[model samples]
Target: MTRHYLRNASIDQPLNVLVATPAGGTGQGGIDRIMAALKAELERRPNGVIARFAPTRGKGALALSLFHLTHFCARIAAWRLQRRLDLVHINLSSRGSTYRKIVIAACARMMRVPYVIHLHGSEFRSFWSNSSPIVDRSIHALFEKASRIIVLGTPWQAFIAERVPNAHGRIVIVPNAVEEPRVAHVGGGASVHILFLGRISDRKGVPHLVKALARMKDVPGWRATLAGDGAVDDLKSEITALGLADRVTVPGWLGPEETARLLATGDILTLPSHAENLPMSIIEAMASGLGVVATPVGAVEDIVKDGKTGLLVPPGDDSALADALSRLVQDGELRQRLGAAAQAFQRRHLSIGPYADRICAVWQDAAAAHRGEASLPALVTPTDLKA
Candidate 1:
């Protein structure tokens, strides 16, 4: 689809950008939530920036391959037709993500548009460390040419600096943010609803969470709900094997409204993930005022305060995971205190407005460097964009 509203090369023009992400809100994972939220936030006020969202990937291998071909044509059309095109913000993950964005980056470079890579992968270092030399070079080349690399946390900032030492200076840390709910989760309900929302795989520690809860059958007024797709039959088998069918509810997968309702009703959210890079489940749980009980992995350690805003356990430790949830289950006051603190932490620090502000500045810097401009007009402050 070719779209051209008004072509303006004048000094006064919005910083136009093309944001390339996956087909979000389409039964995808954390990165999709982050993309949907950030895109909406930027598009909300859009002070002087006209942003265009172009989805790149879909379900399955063939769809993903086709999406690349389809989006490439759309990107070319936008570049050819739009006069105020400034930058391309590419949201990327590990493995296939880097592999795919390499093509997008090359396309951006061909059109002489500055492109930025926003890393959302939880295991990029693992992917980078284990890849063949040829693949590593391709990854390096992609990051090396990018105008900047946006990381989720300082840990990622440092990791990427070491990963692509050549472009270390281009790394920018922008933690994930979610819109706060109007009404927070009512904690300390009659029954403690422990929620685990994510892909039901061993990597996400679904069995571990079920194992933990299976042992806690004696914990009064404590029930658990497992939401999300992937290995659902396997997870159901495991839950059945543990005799937790009565204690746990595996809902398979949830849409946005169902997910929101679950989060809003959940008192304690647990993610004993084997690994993560600031998963949006934890972020959204924090926003909804749920007392978070998660493993200290990735940016989770940075966002969740141990014993304060939320409790953090060592990854892959079922005993610790169970004990953390037990603590919340036993003490209703503790749940309220922690949930309130978690909500406050999210609003005070990780709101979407500041995240959008950082992206706006990054877009401006990328465009200015490419076009030899002095600076952006600084038209929209974070305060003005605050929700």
Candidate 2:
């Protein structure tokens, strides 16, 4: 397929976009980061897209989160009355996220506003495949009503087309993007630094990562940091048991600034997860010009082309993971090449400027479709990002 870009000129009037998500600027999830970055980027640009964030979930209990959702619904009614709502862009995952967005979409439909669905859940396939028939119908209904459905990558676009055939024409692939690194990347001092950014759990393959590092204990001049929340103690214990306590640092979770500092000095970004949906960490790392070593899961293959941008190891295979890491650790030339290519890939396909352009184009299309006007030309899709 030929790569195409959206050529629509900037809107004459400000486009009011109500963004609904779990936690717009406060949450630690990938969806939150993407929304936060998009919001910040849009604010800096005069693109005429006035994005108003409406966080549906919070860090509090379920009832508290639901209360927030209730408030969001009320705001929809209020905004509609004021004639301020032009479109809604919902950032959604599976489970509770889907349920909450269902209500938000219903409210949008009731208020006669066009809304778009952006799927961000990595485990959505399992969540949908194991759901009851009634639940399946509800999900299908949600997508059926969406004016446009956005996915992180081609695989997810295919999933939506297969599951919700009627919505196939509306599906768009706009992978998550990250802002450029604020601090210049100075290669890891002395030793090769391997950084892992994400939750610390079996699902992220933390245990397997620990074992892999243990196998590479004999490989000199290398250290690792497994950063994020969840099962921190278990991971620390396993690292100690493997006698990799000296080389691996388990720093529960990092704030944005801390993570940025690490990225500035890190040489390689690693995430050996068993499941994912285009992790923001990889994008962030690539933006920092770091070589990546990750497992091929979720939409990871969409970005991390093995031997080109980064080295890929089979998930849960500690031996292969160790070998890949060792090769990168010993080959400075290969590390430089991969890191350079990964950074170039990020600039070409995942930079924030083009990402915001694509999203705004989608919002324009959705609103136009809702108003019974001809839709704008298609926006940039995954195929368009290919070199």
Candidate 3:
């Protein structure tokens, strides 16, 4: 099928682009929400950086891989006919994400389309280092070939610069944007509600949180809600064993509305994760006017100033975590103070509109660079449009 193009037409239209990522689900994780928000924003913007979404992963591993391959092949098939695509925006993380995207990057290269890789996973550094030698080399090669590699925070940017030195010049920092609240949250009960949102797993420091709550058992008038799924049985068992079952409730996963309600109830939002890359829970907590008690891992310190916007403790230090939580639990005035600061910070800096605008700029820049490398004609599109 020979699709028509705007050949020699007015240079008003920006280059066509496609975003390839794992999508299509009801609030699966951070990446899904981010992509959905960006897609909505891109559509709203009038001129420059039009986009198409190609979902790569779905359910099962085998099915997901096959779907991704077919999607890439379809794009290549279209390229043969129209050459309409100017950039291949690839969203990635680590492990299988890197593996699949490396292949997709190859396909994009074969199609002569420039590609950009957006890193999302919290444990990406470990993923890169722990992978087999062959996989590591392939990962580096993919990073090197990308026109731009966007990471969530300065921590990741530094990680890539030191770890993937070949991608030093091309790495960019764009933090994750979240639109959510805590669900399964009941409030107005005159109890300090400390909320922990995210996966209930070892990596997320669920055990450490249970221990912290156990430490706070003697502290008066405070309850904790642990939301999200992953190792729920172990988390519940740990809570029971530590005699925190009365004060702590583990609500496996929550919908957006429930999450929002729960976030609204929070006096303090806490996540003592051992590793992270700007976790969406903290951003949402900040947005919801809740004081945050988190470890200074990933970009937690980037947005959260100690004792200003939020409180930070060392990861895996249950005692420090307890002490931090205890401080917030005891001082209602301080909680309100920090929560106000957090909300202000989020509204001013971490809102989705600004995030989308920044991403729009990145897409535009990547497309422009592709034009430069290919010596293609420049698009005379007007700037100043907010994405």
Candidate 4:
């Protein structure tokens, strides 16, 4: 029952794409990775394609008001440009303001330009819960109307398929790919250096990770590093409350090189999020050759193969998380085996080249379809897209 998009040779030409993303860039999460990958693909074009990086402002708005305004401006700018632009690729979070999605999608339709909707994280679930019956119907209408729907993993594909069966054929899964770091085989010891990198938010389960580590205080020679910025005071207070001031290290946010260096010193990377969809941090950790310990959320199960590449526990179970960490901390052979396996997985399947190629095919197919040409067979599958 898996459908694919067939690329039409006639319409398969270099595209001028408008990539819309949140302002801060790739450091945010998977959306950032998608933007980065799309840019990389656009660079490979011989005639050179126009890929404008449009940033949305305002973080706490209900519907991302600033993003919608920015998107509108980008649309106007794209229209004014005399060059031929084939598609508007939108990296949309389900949690983004309804106004933003509606405005952007409507603009694409008005312009008669094919638009690709890239769904990230829990936005789908959020939208499903937030909308009224009428609004929900309209939202599903939008999902069905998109030229193509890009999802992160199998779970999301299923979510969309269950709601919009016909549109399942139009859905394409393209998981985030991590760049392999040059430094390899870094960090592992009795100290069992563990790094938790990401925004310091409740959703990220930072406090949960801290609580888990607090319980393990009796386990000597173990230290946890909290890198990245978010609710600084809250995280610091939690660290103090847990009496893990000494056991836990919060170095705040680090630049790419510095983050890589910090990751290079870790034996294990842990992220016990309540919800997630193919976290870039886990992929980066795997690329860094660190044993990963994460919850079974999003495409995490697809990457951390429980006792194989890494370990996965129930999302909110601190004890299970701690147990998993303890196993890797005590067993060097197991850690090496998992780390090596993870590295191999990344090398074999998660390379950026194949990922970019698949996305390029999606964009080309959408563009071709908009031009009244036959669609391309789906170049990727739900399973293929999983991290």
TM-score of each: 0.90, 0.95, 0.88, 0.88
Candidate 4 stretches greater than 4 Å from native: 1-13, 24-30, 44-49, 58-83, 182-185, 188-190, 383-387
lDDT of 4 by residue, 1-387 (tens): 111332433434447777667653444445665566556554664322456666654345635756556655566457736556678777676644444666677777776777888877554586677778876876777788888999888888888889899988889887777666745555845588988988888888877787788878887777888887878777888898879898888888776667778878888999999888788888888887889999988767877888888998888888888888888888889988998888788876676766666776777777767778777564655545233
lDDT of 3 by residue, 294-379 (tens): 98988778888889988988889999999999998888899889888987778767777667666665666666666674322222
Write down the TM-score for model 3.
0.88
| Local distance difference test, each candidate | 0.77, 0.86, 0.76, 0.73
* Predicted structure with the largest lDDT when compared to the true one: 2
Candidate 3 off by > 4 Å: 1-11, 60-62, 180-188, 373-387
User: Cα deviation of 204 in candidate 3 (Å)?
Assistant: 0.7
Tell me the spans in candidate 2 whose CA falls farther than 4 Å from its real position.
1-12, 380-383
Model 3 error, position 270 (Å): 0.7
lDDT of 4 at 173: 80
By summed lDDT, which 10 consecutive residues of candidate 2 come out lowest?
1-10
Instruction: Tell me the deviation in Å of residue 233 in model 1.
Output: 1.3
Compare candidates 1 and 2 on lDDT and give the better one.
Answer: 2
Compose the digit string of candidate 2's lDDT tens values, residues 19-82.
9978756545788888888888878866656789878998677778878899998988899899
Query: What is the descending lDDT order?
Result: 2, 1, 3, 4
Quickly count the clashes in candidate 2.
1
Model 4 error, position 105 (Å): 0.7
